[model samples]
Target chain A: MAISSFHPPQRTLMGPGPSDVSARVLAALARPTLGHLDPAFIGMMDELKRLLQYAFQTENAMTFAVSAPGSAGMECCFVNLLEPGDKVIVCQNGVFGGRMKENIERCGGIPVLVEDPWGRAVDPDKVEAAFGANPDAKFLAFVHAETSTGACSDAQTLCAIAKRYGALTIVDAVTSLGGSPLKVDEWGIDAIYSGSQKCLSAPPGLSPVSFSDAAAEVIRQRKTKVQSWFLDLSLVMGYWAGEGKRAYHHTAPVNSLYALHESLVMLQEEGLEASWQRHCDLHQQLKQGLAELGIEFIVPEGDRLPQLNAVTIPAGVDDAAVRAALLADYNLEIGAGLGALAGKVWRIGLMGHAANQRNVDYCVAALREVLSR
Target chain B: MAISSFHPPQRTLMGPGPSDVSARVLAALARPTLGHLDPAFIGMMDELKRLLQYAFQTENAMTFAVSAPGSAGMECCFVNLLEPGDKVIVCQNGVFGGRMKENIERCGGIPVLVEDPWGRAVDPDKVEAAFGANPDAKFLAFVHAETSTGACSDAQTLCAIAKRYGALTIVDAVTSLGGSPLKVDEWGIDAIYSGSQKCLSAPPGLSPVSFSDAAAEVIRQRKTKVQSWFLDLSLVMGYWAGEGKRAYHHTAPVNSLYALHESLVMLQEEGLEASWQRHCDLHQQLKQGLAELGIEFIVPEGDRLPQLNAVTIPAGVDDAAVRAALLADYNLEIGAGLGALAGKVWRIGLMGHAANQRNVDYCVAALREVLSR
Candidate 1:
């Protein structure tokens, strides 16, 4: 059988992630590939780290991008910071937090899960109670913005509660980073992992992660070797730490990093606060339009993530048929609910470059047409 | 402090891996970001698997690309197949073999080392003897082509010996797949992994891997869960299988997979035998030119990989200074030796798109000029 080059359709990505990438970012991705250790490439990597630090709003020396996706970045935090028999308090409200539990278990850490109902923020009181009961817990982990439910947790409150109990925090900022107000250093987030495809407006593949000094110190003092060698921060830091004479790690995803650098630079140019406001403004517009169509949100207004809007599927509306129609007719891609919310909700994303009046209007009109038909 | 967008210099990459991506592949990478689970994206992924199967020359149903780099692919093989308390025979001749040992230990498997000198291919006799000594060994893992030492082991002979002892074999074809002759099914390799950056002429980040029916069965029947959830084949297969309703794994590194698809398509256009011959032809040209400058190869002609030429550095040559001059003065990048051979050898790569006569001539001329200075 003969195969030819794939010409992907120009998609309006209004899904959970891989949010619409700007042409400038795409152009950056197509730039000439360079050797991972090339001096010029290394210089660019240093700048990439700086840009990531700014996006994360932290001065973490261990800030850099993981070569894989956000899942691997989540593993990096757990496998490095927690060892066998270590106790951790994990809050589960969405798919990502559940993944954190899996990572903890794989690393041989004992997890005490604080459960929250779906379409709701992680209950800070429940997390505090978990810490109170398991006073020896070494880490407190939760998702800052749950992509599966579009629920936004209060990361600062959770981190402060964890710190009061002397437990470090690992936050999943995959869908929250640039779309919302997140101050890593000021919020006392010890370790945070995010994706380039979300609010960063880059293509998928690279995961931007940061570790504070306290988190770095815990990794340095590990009694056991990191369970997953590929996700080990101790060795990864040597490659990303742009000090004198950098060490060789794996060949970084050179082109993906190029895309990330461009996206982060755009974030810097727009300023983090402005990017957050843009997402919020677009969310308001989308909300008003959806409400007019008699659609209801799964998450409450106060707890909703501006970047990702989770709405209840109206009765008698075939969930798959509507989403399929949206893609087939409008060339728009919105997400279907995952896990417990499967077939019950649709996720509409207004993230990074996708957060604009044009996309919002197109999405609303498309939904109206599809629903009416 | 303000930072501008990064503009990487156009470099002629003649390194160990990431050996010059083609413009078409780069363009494919930048085409358009798609939601990972989009129907069109899934169609592209199905085609990607077919293309990968052709490249690996396998009928293995479980063939697909890992979302991370080659190292993660390596971990995937070990973590999925070998559980705690299992014994495996690991052949250590170069850098990657040593890494396999680390992965085995991290997975709680006992590794019986079959040691060969650096720059030498794996000895089948030593492997058989290790099997003789440890009759209960579950796996035999070795590198088919050692990128660090530019040595090509006899994969067919090694796999035949491992099968005789009822042990599954895992082959690292990172630098071998397109540049050399490798038949995964015919060679009886139970599992194999390759990097996209090397012979595929794609930018770094994706690892194309294949598992034989026997290997997949072992993974399916594992008593314990795969240690790394992100790299776990059990979960990953559902997403890549593409036969029925595809399951969602981590967002499929959508753009990277697009680049891999284009590269594999190009590989099909140029027949595999032709690609191998091209690398061999370029290697001969490079070898003769290096010999004229009084440089010698570390590996014997029979064992040396045609794509990666490892040559002994002159006794008094300032290795770093020479490499820096090649980069700054000529815009060419060659790799320095790693681990045991560091500072003693230079690795000049002629793989995929970089294996043309123009690159060969330019690399030799640049080396001659830099060496004379």
Candidate 2:
């Protein structure tokens, strides 16, 4: 059996990421594939690390992109920092937070769970209380912007709380990096990971991550070898460390890095704060439009994420049917609620290149036409 | 500080892996990005699996591409199959075999070393003896093609030997697939992994992997959960399994899959045997040219890999200076030897779309001009 070339249909991606990539990033992905060790390529890699530092709002020397997706980035943090039998304070409010617990446990770390309702922000007081109860906890982990429920937690407050307990923090900034204000250094985040497709406007593949000096030291002093060699920071650092003297760890996803470098360059052109405001502005426009259509949000206003808007499914509406119709009729893609919120809510995303007045208006108009029928 | 878009220099790639990619694969990568769960995207994914199956020459149901590079693929096999305290025979011929041992030790498995010379294939007699000494060995791991030394081992004999001792086999075919005769099913390889950049002529990133039915059964009946959640086969299987009813694992490298699909399609069009023969033909041309220039191969002819040629550096020649001159003067790239062979040898790759008479002639002509200077 012979397989032909795949020509993907043009899509308006406003779902839980891979949110619309711009033509610039796509063009970058088509650039000639260079040898990973080529001097010209290494120059671009150094610039990429600097650009990633700017996007992450940190001056971390350990900042680099993982050659895989976001989940691998999460695993990298857990495996490198936590050892067998270590204790961690894990906050579980949405799907990604649950995944964090799994990472912790798989690394042989005992997690003390801090639970909150799905559509609400993680309760900071509860996290503090859990830390107080489990004083032996070496790390605190949570998601800043929960894509599953569109709830935004107070990262600054949580990090401060963890610091007070003498514990390091691992923050999942996958949905918050460019769409929201995330100051890795100012907020005292020790280790943070974000996805390229989320708000960077690159295709889904690379995970941009940063570790503070303190976190790097902990990795350097690890008592046992990292469980996942591919995600191990010690070995990976050698490859991503210096400009000309770098060692070969693995063949980087060359084209994917090209796309990411372009996306980060675009991010620099439009300043970080301006990008965050754009997301907020588009979310406001979408909110007003949805309100006029009698749609209500699942998350409260204060706890909501501007990039990911989770809303209640209207009574008597067939959730999958409506989403399928929108895709079939208008080529618009929104996300269905995952895990506990499945069939109960719809997640509409306004992220990076997808966040604009035009996309907001088109999504609102498409939903109205499909729902009223 | 502002940064401009990166325009990478166009260089002829002839490194160990990440060989020259075709215009067709690059164009496929630049196509519009799509949602990972979109129906049309799912259709492409199903097609990708079928294409990968054809490339690996297997009918195994658990065939798919890992969303990372080859190292992650190596981790995926070790973590899922071996558990804590499990003993395995690890054959070491070059850099990758040592990496496999590190992976085993990290997974808490004890590695029984079966040592061979650096530039030679794994000795099948030594492997059989190691299995005899360690009757409790659960796995026999070896590299089918050592990219570091340009040696190709007899995968058929190794797997057959492992079977006789009631041990599963893990084969690293990173540089062998599509460039040589690798019959996954006919050789009875239990688990195998290959990189997209090597013989497939796609850009770096994405590891195509396949597991026989017996290996899949062992994974299903594992005593403990897979150590790394991101590389967990049980959970990943759910996402790659089923047609149109797939579950979400992580967001796949969407555009990378497009490149792989195109590469595999090209491979299918030139039949596997034809592709292998192309590499062989190009290798012969390169060999004759290099011989005239007084270059000597590191590996014996019988065990040498046509895709990767490791040649000894001539006495009194400045290795780094010559390679740098080749890059600067002719816009060409070759590989420096790794590990013990570093500075003593140079690796020239002839794989996939890079395996052609034109590249061979250009490489030889460039090398001769630089060396004579």
Candidate 3:
């Protein structure tokens, strides 16, 4: 069967992730494929690690991108840190939290989930209670920003509580890194994972993750081997974190890493704090415009992720139809509510390069037209 | 902290994998990033599956590209197929085979290894004997082309032996897919994985994998969940195999898939057999030139992979120095030996788009110049 080269339609990506990759990042992806171990590529990898440390606001020394997407990043944390029969106190606020539970279970770890409402942040009180109840829980895991519901949990507080209990904290920063104020080192996050597509505005595939020294020490002392040979950090770090001579773990996604590097470089140029403010500023603009259209956010104002706005779908409105109209009429894309929130909300994203006045105006106008129809 | 956009040096990649990606594929990589669930993107995914099917020469409906590298692809096969305590007759002829064993143990499956010398093909007799010794062995895994040592095993013979033993066969076709003859359905291979970087002329991220009906059945009937949350075929299939409404799994590497699609399209235009012949013909050219420079093939001639030339470094010539000079003076990248052959051999790749008369001539000339020094 003869098939031609694919030319994807240009859509204004205002979805949960993969939000409007800049021309620079896309161009970087098209650069010549390099050998994974090439000195020049290795040099670029070092720069990439430094940039990731900057994005995550950490100097953890173990920050690097997982070869796969954010889902794999979540798995990386669980598999490396938890052996069979290990206990973790996990907080579930939205879709990603449930996914974390899956990862924990798949790692053969007992997950004592501290449940919360879908659009609400992880209650620090409940997390504390859960840890208090399961005093043997060695890890406390939670999402900093729930992409599914656009809720921003109190990471600093949650981490502080975990630390008080002598438990390591694994944070899912997929929707928070480079889009909001996520201070990994300051919050004392034991481990964290983020998505390149979400706030970095790179093509989806690579997952940027970081680990605290405590988490590293735990992995080092683990009695059992990490279940995933591919996601094993001990082997992975030999390739990513080594100096002078880097051991080959697997052939890295050289071109995708180039895109990630360029995206991180863009994040560097804009500056992390400025990038966070840009996302917050644009969210306010979109919020006002959505207010004019009688749309309401499902997440409360104080605990919302500015980059991912989970707004309630109007009564009697067709979720699929509205999203289709946006795509067909305006070449725009918005996320349908995932998991429990399905059909109830639309996730309008203002991430990275897409967090600008033009996209905000375009998205709001498109939504208004679609809703009017 | 200061950083600039990474402008990589233009080098001719004649390494083990990440073989020279064509301009068309690289241009496709630079194309606009589309949302993972975009209808247009879904349509592209369908075409991509068909292309992968064509490349693997399989009619299996479950064929698709894994979002990670080849190593992850290997893990996906192992985790999905083997339940804990299952016995797999694994053949180790080179580096990837050893990696497969690691994956087997990580999945809690017992790997009964059938060994062969590193630079030699996996002996089918030894594989048959292993199955004979362990009649309970239900799985047989081996690499068709050993990337580490340029040894091309007899996959057809090995699969036939496994079929005789009533075992499912898993084949690693990473370095063999487009450059050499590989017929998945004809060989009755149950599960096979290949990399986009090798012979496919794509960037080094995606791994194209196919599962026969039998392999798919094994995954379906498995009682335990696949240990890898990211690599689980059951959940992964919901996203990849769905016709109308694709379930969101992980965000696929969108732009990288664009490059993979374009590379496969180019493979389609140049028929698979013709491409295989081109690699073989170029190998002959490179072989003759290497012989002129007093270099000897490490693997016996017949067993050697045409796309990857594993030749002995000239006596008294420094392996690092020659490879370094090739990069420094000629802007050429040939792979240094891996594992057991580390300092003894150089892996000169003639794979995919790099399998041309000019590249063969350039690589041979560069090696000759460095060796003479």
**Which model scores highest in lDDT?**
2
Enumerate residue pairs that collide in model 3. Answer: none
* Residue pairs in collision within model 2: none
Error at B283, model 3, angstroms: 0.5
Question: Each candidate's root-mean-square deviation in Å?
Answer: 0.9, 0.8, 0.8
Candidate 2 lDDT over residue span A102-216, tens digit each: 9999999999999999999999999999988998899999999999999999999999999999999999999998999999999999999999999998999999999999999
lDDT of candidate 2 over B93-158, digit per residue (tens)? 999999999999989999999999999999999999999899899999999999999999999999
Q: Kindly indicate the candidate among 2 and 3 with the higher DockQ.
A: 2
Query: Please, what's the RMSD in Å of model 1?
Result: 0.9
Report every candidate's CA lDDT.
0.93, 0.93, 0.93
Write one digit per residue (lDDT tens) for candidate 3, span A1-373: 5798787788899999899999988889989888999999999999999999999989999999999999999999999999889899998989899999999999999999999999999999998899889999999999999999999999999999999999999999999999999999999998999999998999999999999999999999999999999999999999998777999999999999999999999889888889998988999999999999999999889998999999999999999999999999999999999999899999999999988999999998988888887
Regions of model 3 farther than 4 Å from truth: none
Candidate 1 lDDT tens digits, A1-373: 8989898888899999999999999999999999988878888899999999999999999999999999988988888899899999999998888999999998889999999998999999999889889999989999999999999999999999999999999999999999999999999999999999999989989889999999999988988898888888888878889476788878899999999999999999999999999999999999999999999999988999999999999999999999999999999999999999999999999999999999999999999999999
